[model samples]
Target: MMPMTITEIAEAVGGTVTAPFAGEHAGGVPDGEVARSATSDSRLVGEGGVFVAIKGERVDGHDYVAGLGAKGAAAAIVDHAVSDADVTQIVVDDTVEALGALARHNIERRRADAGKPFTLVALTGSVGKTTTKDLLKSLLSTLDETVAPVGSFNNEIGLPLTALTVNADTRYFVAEMGANHVGEIARLTTIAPPDIAIVLKVGVAHLGEFGSVERIAQAKSEIVRGLLPSGTAVLNADDAHVAAMRSIAPADVVWFGIDPAHADEDALTVRELTTDDMDHPSFTLVAANGDTADVRLAIPGAHNAMNALAASTVAHMLGMPLDDIARVLGEQRRISPHRMAVSTVERDGAVFTLIDDSFNANPDSMRAGLDGLARWGAGRKTQPYRVAVLGAMLELGGDEQGLHRSIGAYAAELGLDRIVAVGSATDAEFDALAGALAEGACTAIASRGGTAAVDWVHDADEADRLVTSIASEHPGTVALLKGSHASGLSTLAERWAPADPARR
Candidate 1:
């Protein structure tokens, strides 16, 4: 974050400096001291950092204010004072509201100091928001100082924290907007409105929260609506719902997709796309100006091709050459962990290809991960055995059971050799959900009338044991682990892919 004087911070948040300077500078901090960064987590506070005390469900950050002095913190913004601690205090009515105010003030300061306004890019979708953001950040950093959120920090508090990190030197600010309900993205756009807004596909990611697919599309369209009058809207032409956003876009529109029907003079399109044995995609990137470059992504998955096109289109609009964009994308590896991460595991003289896409799951991503596994297994020289370890996909609302059943049936149709459904039916409240998934998968496999085996486990440990046994028996086995965050499938992936001693 850029440096801000203590006096300036208090004024930005409309708070008062009450301690450590009662008589100095009219009860304000000394003018020489500055806050280097802003964070709510006390553990991240440094000597010149500003700590915002927030009240959470399990813990109150006000309790941690007393220890900041020993940590060398510059000041703490809290709802109340801690008389026992020797820390400087900025008293505010609400710390969360103060945080937003401070971040907005910082952004305005950056714009004034930059002399020319910096570009603000906002992106939203049901899936691939993080991967596309990472790609855009990589491509933008080659040309200038870029600031993006770490992981999926795309919500209200997370978005504000990321905005505070920007300074005068930052030329590009990539804000990822996410929503589980309507108006969430609208609120985020008010904090830092986008000069360029990209809307990926609108799918059934948070169906439970929004109640229907139409509502999900309505929520995703808020990003396009929040754009500046002169902003550019980057949209996916293949998605009908996303394509319809052009009518509501306040500025110029740039379309991107693999379908030829969406191609135009100013569209960024893809052609002749194919995935390798490991599911890494390669395609010819054609710019609207007729310039073309072949892009081979290091990341594994056919679905990532669309993500690449989205990032490339944004970069092209920002004055990056087509060749440079393709070159940098080829050199890019996995930035965020647990999203279609491919690794080889050696155990008991057998090698298994592990596709760790267990970070989070919705119906769209679940289908994409399963397709990757099918393609990877089919491309093997010896025709390796295929195994799918799926867990419950939550936030699916009333039709959650039917959705889980359909996913199970789809996995069966993929011709996987084995299916392990991970969940327990022991809990009275969760039994219907878990039981439906397992029963649906088993029933589908039975209908196939093949040698493909299906098992239902109550926990990750049982699923891990079964998967280990399968890998041990079949040397060239390929396995996929996909589920929501609460399913504990990511933990199973970590157990398989332990830290390397050499890296440590």
Candidate 2:
């Protein structure tokens, strides 16, 4: 963060500074005393950095303030000052709000510096926010210093912490915005407004929280509405819900998609979109002004083409050539963990392929994972046995069962060798959802006279046993683990694919 004194930070957040150390002045620390960075976790506190003491559900950060000084922290921002803490304390009504205030102050300071101004790009969508951010960060960094969140740090606290990482040398700040309800992104946009906004596909990831798909689209469009008049809006033309957002866009719109039918007069388009045996894509990247380059993605899924195009559009807007954009895209092999990560496991003299996409799942991402698995199996020379070990997808509103059933039917339609539905045995509601998925596949297989097998396991342990049995029987098996984080599938994936580079 741009250096700010304890007095300046307290003033920006409307807080009171108290308990100046023995060597400090009477009115807080000296004017030269400042914090270089900010963090909510006390364990991450560094020398000359400020710590925000947040009160979470179980551990209150205020308890950790006593040890901040020994860790070389400059000061602590707390909701209430710790009595015996040696460090200077800035007391506020809420520590989370104070962190946001400090981040906003840091951004304003960078904008005010004429010699070191940075452009901020903000993006939000239901499924691909993190993946798109990762791709965009690599492309933007080719030009100059770029700051982006480490993972899916797109919520209130996450966005602010990422914004505070910007300093004088930073040229681009990629902000990934996420929301569970209406107006959440609007609140975040207020913290760090974007010079370019990207609106990816609006799916039903949070359908339960927002009540309807229309409401979900409304929430995603806030980024476009939040953009300044001079800014640009990079939109996906493939999704009708996202395409409809153009009507409400507050700035210039740039379209990007795979279909020529959806392309605007001068939109970014793709051709010959094909994937290899590992599901990596080789496509021709077409620019708005007729410039084209061949892009062969190192990432596993063909679905990532949209993500790559979105990132490339922003890079092109920033004056990067199409050839450079394609080259950078081909070099990004692995992204944040559990999103189309591929690995091989050896067990009892048998080797099998494991596609661990169990980080989180919604209907849209679930289908994409299944599609990738199908392509991987089809591309094999020997036609390997494919298995989909899927758990319940959460937060799908009243029709959650129907959605689960559809996913099961989709797996069966893909002709996967086996479908294993997994859920907690103790939780009847979740277990029933898993059963519905298995039942759907069973019915579909029966109707088509297909011999595909289906099973419903009680939990991840049961899934492991069943999968191990199948792998021992079928050595060339390819298995996929896809589900919401609550299902414990990602933990199972980590245990099996511990050496996968994406998880690291």
Candidate 3:
């Protein structure tokens, strides 16, 4: 958000300034110039920033106009009426949409000037986008100054916001793109379109909006569509569905995989797995040119091995040495507080290891979690139960129920000690698991009250209560908490783990 004018913002979003300068207009203010740097929901406003007041299904931003004035907002972009005592205001049909346009405009201005900037890398998928972003940041940071999408800012608004975060000093920009519908990735790609695009894989994530995995792949492939003509596309060679994404790119394609079977087939791959006594994984890194070296992973799971391979491919394409790339990644931290966060829980008699994967889950990630759990839980004997507080995986659309049922069947087949389910899909899962699973290992329809007919997920307390009740009913468990972003299943895991009661 370089400094711009209020009149320019009005031009940008097709909003009109309802009032001229009512408040004291400063002498140095550019005729209509107003600062529209970042989006803010706070009641307080900055001296020059354009404050967008949005209306939701419930709350209206119109109510906060004067409140914005009280906080010295340079100009208020409003949808409804503003009565009295105002600075400057732009009235629009909707503030949220205005905010989106303003963001897109801001990024386009910077990108149009990217002649002086470095190569851009964009990562997208149902799972591991954040982890891959972190890995790229780690590897690229060794090469030059880097800018990355912070946290989970990978949406329509988040994409532009991340682009705005980049400046002239950044040598590399890593953008994490996320979507749930057909046009989101395409829309996001319009901003921060990458020089190098990484697609983790396609699975049942966000299936609600897009309908099927094929549609999801099409939506994600928009990253390539949005790329510069000479950019590279990096893909998951192991994902059968994602195998075709390379064709979508106008430039070169870089391939990465974790399967040793694919290791010799010319794709860059990482193999040679060894789990430590602590059960964390270490592996060998194999480049596309047939070079190989051993590198220990800070992140757990076979999925992360694939993640490292993807990171390695990007680094190799960017001209990093084979050996140096492995060493830097071998010591970097796994994306924090996400899956494989090692923690311990105290029971009546002994300690049980707890691995928190509560950020979010999809079909691909759920299977990865089960495999990781198998590695961690296989040798522990005192484990009373291998617990999974599985919640409704949203966005599967027509396939939601079937996907949940399949996961349930898979969990039972894995011989997990117990399963606790939330969401409507679990009812389908329960029906699938009941006959195939032993009596004690599987449970279903376990929302707040355990009613069979309820279809939605429970609250944090409810999810936590489910965990407590389950633990009380059967103690000494190793719990794996997984669900979609909206699941709030992290609350359940947090409550069960050792936390300040106030925090809980």
Query: Which stretches in model 3 have alpha-carbon errors above 4 Å?
Result: 18-22, 26-36, 43-48, 67-73, 84-87, 92-94, 112-115, 260-267, 277-279, 289-291, 334-338, 345-352, 377-385, 423-476, 497-504
* Tens digits of per-residue lDDT for model 3, 1-504: 656677777887788776633445422234655574544454435666566676667876667666554465667777765776365777788766677777667655666675566778988887888888888899999988787876788886566656655555567888999987888888877666678889988877877788777899898888888888998888787888787877778987777877756544446676677775335567877766678888877666766777777888888888888788889887865564656665665544344456678788878898888666655546566544666656656666665666676776566556566566654333554333222222222333221122211112334555455555556666655666777656656665665565421110
Candidates arranged by TM-score, highest first = 2, 1, 3
- lDDT score for residue 233 of model 3: 81
Q: Candidate 2's residue-wise lDDT over 221-275, tens digit each?
A: 9999888778888899998988888888786888999898888865778999999
Models 1 onward score TM values of 0.94, 0.96, 0.80
Candidate 1 lDDT, tens digit per residue, 1-504?
778888889999999887653223234455577888999999999889899999999989988887676677788898887665556789999998899888878877876784756999999999999999999999999989999999889987899999989987889999999999999999888888889999999999989999999999999999999998999999999999999999999979989999978876788889899998878899999876678999999888899999989999889888999999999999887668788877777654666778888889999999999998888846656887899888888898889999888888888878889888888544433445556666777777787655677787777778777888899888788889899887777778888883431110
| Over 4 Å off, model 1 | 21-28, 347-350, 425-432, 500-504
> With candidate 1 superimposed using the best TM-score fit, by how many Å does residue 297's alpha carbon deviate from the native?
0.8
- Can you tell me which runs of candidate 2 are displaced by over 4 Å? 20-31, 500-504
Clashing pairs in 2: none
Better of 1 and 3 by lDDT: 1
Compared with the true structure, all predictions reach lDDT values of: 0.85, 0.87, 0.67
Best by TM-score: 2
Candidate 2 local Cα displacement, residue 491, angstroms = 1.5
